[model samples]
Target: MVDADQTFVIVGGGLAGAKAAETLRAEGFTGRVILICDERDHPYERPPLSKGYLLGKEERESVFVHEPAWYAAHDIELHLGQTVDAIDRSAKTVRFGDDGTAVRYDKLLLATGAEPRRLDIPGTDLAGVHHLRRLAHAERLKHVLTNLGRDNGHLVIAGAGWIGLEVAAAAREYGAEVTVVHSGPTPLHSVLGPELGQLFAELHREHGVRFHFGARLTEITGQDGMVLAARTDDGEEHPAHDVLAAIGAAPRTHLAEAAGLEIADPAHGGGIVVDERLRTSDPDIHAAGDVVSFPHALFDTRLRVEHWANALNGGPAAARAMLGHDVTYDRVPYFFSDQYDLGMEYSGWAPPGSYDQVVIRGDAGKREFVAFWVKENRVLAGMNVNVWNVTDTIQRLIRGRARVNTEHLADPHIPLEDLAP
Candidate 1:
């Protein structure tokens, strides 16, 4: 039983934190809620940064979750440009750096999120080498692209994940010579599986994007204040004018660990460990979004998904638990990526080597298809490329834990809606 006057301090003002604050207010919790964000801007959507924002198709103001006036009207205090330096669990306070303010909370939500992983290779700190995470990063990249003369600049991306591919697509659209170096056998192989990944490889190649699959970069060399070349472990060198490191991201968990909270093992991958109810080891503190690892009932495994859908859905679930109404974060995970006029949607969970059956719902050669991962007649996961409606149907089917015959799933004539539970 918590008092209505008690304060709730939410660290990190990304989508998760903003959604939690909104959920708290919507659920009729009239306590003092303060959202602390490190960025100058209010909580903004990050997925568009690599695609629409990078391509200049979306305005900066369009990224914000809510207007500043909205927060003021809702009585939610927005602490912009403030970084949480430390967490004092014993004192139930968080120390911020910008103002050196120590705020105590009756309840705290950790949504510090993640930072872009950097390449440890030599000369990675040189000029013309960058990593995209914040709006500042995108602005810097945009400046570089604008000044470098799109027709002549060579952009080298160091990963094949969604961010790397999206950035590559934007760069290609601007007429930059784009090349992606990935250690994986195919782009998005780990997420979409090999067969579908192969299709993406062909698509990118057809668009004049070069790929170095299974190639590991050993070092980045700079010449005369600019990135000159990248050397690979296989003794090959590739010339480049700019380098973008998109190796992935790790959870920002230092503050949580310093506060004596149980952290997830690196074996389970790096992130804080949380229960199904989104509560950490300390019930007074909760965690959600990309920073927390929790068990997935569908996959029968623990996963830390750094997707927009997870942040949006899990944040509200955490708020429910904080307000003494425990709700499991069991929604089927979904995410999207826009690359080169193609939209991709992924739903459900699929552990490596777990799916025994895979069915393609449409023509893969035509650049529109839905690949379903099935285990023991149950739809475990799905990835749809350029098929929007199928993704929505798959999302509902996943939530219902629908079981379907793989044979019918492969037949394009069989309506996917009929597979509903």
Candidate 2:
């Protein structure tokens, strides 16, 4: 039986932290559960912030991970708008807020996620410049979109990653003129690489979105505390009623670093280092979500995934591990995105240099296809675009780690099931 007198503290109030608390209860751990969030709002998921919620299709209430009453009903102590300043490892306590109030814990979990990387450019503080990372940010952006929809305002977006592209799609739907500025050759260059990135670029172009590749904002020109235009390093100027900085996000790891936990190096994407069980260097403390960089034996490297699926699954996995259960979180990395009329689900990890060639199984022009990244005829990763119900077989092929026939993979009639066996 679990210790009912024990206290478990979870820091960060997002999907990961919320799910961890729920798992603790579900696993029959009758202990005091304290969940601390820097934001005043209850724990919520982040995907909707940039997608449905921002598009006005999803209500604000739907973004939350659970109903407001669920925490109290489950006997969880939920602290809101409270930032943990430090972790006192020696005393086994977490100090928070201006007064440095301490909360002692027998075991602790750090689910601190990531923060949007700010652009170091002039006029960023202007009224029309924004960043979308939280519920509040989306709220402001939604209002801006409504007004832009009515006024036909021009929105200049910096970066062409998922956030930038998603917001661009939303802006276009709102009847706003959208221009994306990206430093790479095409949109999603870091993730999809050039080939698939070009496909996205074409998709956005067909939706009337303009692309300014090989450029980044050198300055944001404004008048009367309102954005007017953005000037790029390539000496091109684009008119802008509003500007969005969606460059990227960095893991929030100050507390973990100050507490002297093992941190992954910057080159490998810095994050709090954890084992396969999501256990940190300190045996009493574990970590999950974007803040966690753990060993993936399957990939033969350490990875820190910031996608929604990571937090959705990692939290419960960590919670079970904290409860002294045998847990090996080797789930293959997965993420999906919706843009315009096209939707895609990608499984496994394949960066630009990691795979030798890409094989296509369907019509790329129709935007209905399955693409696989192969290295020496072994499937490293697969993505299904505007295709459905093959995630299971695709994941099995990845986990199989055996050589696959490129002809079978490229043939649409050859079922994905056949490739696995």
Candidate 3:
């Protein structure tokens, strides 16, 4: 166990880093705890950036993890808008990128989160093209969307992932025409499979959003450094006064790489490699959040999850492991999204091609269904769409690993709890 006099340093002031500081204090770690963030604002929930905040339903202050006074009250040092350039593992010090300011630590936690991925296409740096990752990005997009009502222009989204669909919904709510271009045949096809993905595609279609499926954004053409249209590989161009490229995100792993940590293989997106306890190769330096690729107890291969719940839960697990406590950082990965009038909650890990078949219990056409991904009658993952408060039961069925009856599983009359072992 670390002594009370030792100092703990946490990099990246996102939800993961904030939660780690909270966990350290709650776990009775009296040592010095410092959180360094690159953003000017305090740590905040990012999920709201795409949904409530972008829609102006939530205030900016409410997105922050805590008030500015809360950090000082807890005796936790807050280093805002600081970039950590490098980590000297042998000396246990993290140096700043700009002024080379260095701070030594007894234990370091790397919660450096992911950044939005950008395409190498033309006109990416144009004025009207944007990507949503930070609060600043969302605020900028919000301003553009506010002007769309007067401009009478359309928003062209480059990807059909969770962020793309959610933003499309919000933009449509604000009276801007929206068009989505995706490489897949249906929205979220890689994750939810065609059946469920089509349901989402249909949901957006019903809400007056256009989709160009099986297409790639070849270039984003602009006039005078402002986005004008997004052209696709199929020789089709869609008018877009504003463009949001919600392609995906990549883990911010430059610091970890420079520190000589064991990064995951290139095939696995090259995240920092960590054990089940979230410990990096260097015992004193632990990694959590989207930047980590750790072995899952329930899955065969190493997995790296980028979702709100993973960051919310993984931070505490990493903190417990840092205190010389024996811990296995294992939890059923969960994620949720709200698009238009539909809301969904998915639990457990089922990568693409992992599950053989999907069994649905309510009407998918009506947009109220509980879908279970099964292989050999063992539930791999489950999703409840427009259905409330059954995630616990769904997760249990996946963990129990009992043989399930497909007929009963598809019967809406059967309670999900009864399917569990």
lDDT (CA) for every model shown?
0.86, 0.93, 0.90
Q: Estimate each model's TM-score.
A: 0.96, 0.99, 0.98
Per-residue lDDT over 121-186 for candidate 3, one digit per residue giving the tens place of the 0 to 100 score: 988889998999999999999988888856777999999999999999999888899999999989
lDDT of model 3 at position 72: 92
Name the regions of candidate 2 deviating beyond 4 angstroms: none
lDDT score, candidate 2, position 411: 94
Model 1 agreement with the true structure over 39-88: per-residue lDDT tens digits: 98889878878988888898988888888799999999899899999988
Ranking by TM-score: 2, 3, 1
Candidate 3, superposed: residue stretches over 4 Å from native:
none
Candidate 1: stretches off by over 4 Å: 148-151
Candidate 2 on 155-202: residue-level lDDT in tens? 999999999999999999889999999999999888888989999999
Could you say which candidate leads in lDDT? 2
Model 2 Cα shift for residue 30 (angstroms): 0.5
Ranking of all predicted structures according to lDDT, beginning with the best and ending with the worst: 2, 3, 1
User: Of models 2 and 3, which has the larger lDDT?
Assistant: 2
Give candidate 3's error at residue 61 in angstroms.
Answer: 1.4
